[model samples]
Target: MRTAIVVGAGIGGVATALGLGRAGWQVTVLERAPQLGEVGAGISVWPSAVKALQQLGVTGLEKASVVSAPAGMRRPNGQWVVKASALGLELPVMVHRAQLHELITSGFGSGVTVRTGVTVDGFADGAVRAGGEELRADLVVAADGLRSVVRDALYPRYAGPRYSGYAAYRGIADVELEDGGGETWGRGRRFGFARLIDGRYYWYATENRAAGAVGDVWSAFDQWHDPIPELLEATKPEAVLQNDIYDLPLPLVPFAQANVALLGDAAHAMTPNLGRGACTAMEDAAALVRHVTGPAAIPAALTSYDAERRPVATKLVRVSRNVGRVGQLDGRIAAAVRDGLLLTGGKVAGLLARRRSG
Candidate 1:
């Protein structure tokens, strides 16, 4: 049987290993951490990603579990900018990050082996050196995340992560919310919330700040609408997760080189504006598994995976970065112009939806 080694045991890495195992490849998962788990508050799984997981042998997600996109965009003052129903946007199922990770990892089959505390140091043709030992396989998959050592080593000259001139704060809040939550956009900052399946709110906020600058982020939204402040109040200060936003530069380098393939943030980390980062990574794994399990040779399979995922991921990265730029517009005049355009666009979209439904 063909064998594969997947570096990193995060959501994307585990998903890749599970898919390869289901596809009949013996997979060894290398996790640098002492144990297997995921950090973060909540994750938004889009429909396509859900199907991709199912294709990878994941189950238990009912069609009904998909929720409406947050009720649309709002102003920091709670005024409506555009209702989600108006935009007729595709919705995603919100889940706790750890829960989603567990769900994907649960699909691991007997052909799969996991090695924690195995910090991958470097790699060569179909082999990887980790923790003072070298292991060889038919294929090597690098899913080591944004600061991927494999990625860095492979393309030492590759211009890596480009900061998005802002930072994001995310948390799960236990506060009660009557209405479906949505995003509140303001000048140079924004706040969004969504109800998770477990009866809690998954909220995220962004603001323009110098990289690595930390302070009371809540102060910006404190005087905003009801429940905005309450959500923060309910979340413990330390529990709120924050990260400076970043995405790989456009025309992302190819996903495959020799017998190795890069997956997830290692390949296409993007700003969170579109909420498609993790979902895209899962899709990449599915594509890799599909081609590998097909009649094509492994080399051809890697080429197909690269061809299929790179273009799509490139487009998403571009659009998501553009959205962040527009969403974080500064200055009163700029925001007013943005709100006007959005309101007008919302009306047009709502009318289109109404016409279709009618």
Candidate 2:
């Protein structure tokens, strides 16, 4: 029987392992954390990601539920800048990252082995060194993450992720919302909120700074505008989760080498501006499984994966970064221009819809 080793048990890693196991590969998943959990607060799972989850038999989304609704954006002063329906599907269905992790982890059957508290240092040929133990397999999938050690071994010249010059402060509060999701754009600052399935509002704020914790991030937004202060003040400090935003460079040059292949953030990391980060990762795992287990040669399958995903994902990364600029526009004139463009162009509506679809 074919054997597979997947590094990292996060969304991408677990999904890949589950897909491969379902495809008849004996799989082992290595996770550094002692126990699996979600890193960020709330993640928006769009239709594309949902489709992939359905493929993997992740049937617990409704049970581990966060709120589901259409998403919108506003200015710092609390004025609506842009609004759009989620269309046939909900723009975002809020779910705790940890619950999502649990959903994927539960899919690993007898054919899959999961190792927690184990860190993968590097990989060579068809083997990975994890926690000082060497394990070999017919194929190694590096679903590790942005700082993927496997990716570093495969392409050291690529270095690692780059900071997007902004940090996001996130939290969830038991506040009454209008049953919708919203984002407030400010000068080099941004804030947004969504109603989670648990009936709590998931909110996040962004600022121009390095990727790390800051003192009193809510205090930083105290003077911004309406609702901003209310949202921050109403929440407890313990609930807030903050991290700097970063993205991997695109054109991942060569996504594979012989029996090894990169997936998820390891392959094409990008900003969350479009909220397609996880969705794209799920798509990558789904696409790879179809090819690898469908009678195509390893090299040929990888070639097609790169060909099909590179152009679409590269475009997404570029567009997402540009959207970040739009959200963080500084200066009075720049803000005015952004507002004008959004209101007059009516082009943003379609662009946003496309983002959700991908």
Model 2 C-alpha lDDT per residue in residues 1-358, reported as the tens digit of each score: 8888888887888888888898789998888899876687778887788888888767889777654565566776667766655333356577888778888888778999988899888787667998778898877888888888888888879858978888878887777756466777888888887777777777888788756647577667888666667677778998787778898776565667777878888888898898889888888888888778878778788878878877778888899999987887778899889987886554555576678789
Task: Give the range of the ten consecutive residues with the poorest summed lDDT in model 1.
Answer: 61-70
Give all TM-scores, in the order shown.
0.97, 0.91
Task: Please give, for residues 1-358, the per-residue lDDT of candidate 1 as tens digits.
Answer: 9999899988889999999998888999999889999999888889999989989998765532447454988897789989987666789888888988888888888999999988888865556888788899888888999888888877888999999999999988997879698888999999988988767898999999999999576887899898899999989988989889989997898898877889999999999999999999999989988888888877788888999999999999999999999999989999999999999999999999888888
Off by over 4 Å in 1: 63-66
Total clashing pairs in model 1: 0
lDDT (Cα, 0-100) at 31 in candidate 1: 93
Deviation from native of the Cα of residue 10 in model 1, angstroms: 1.5
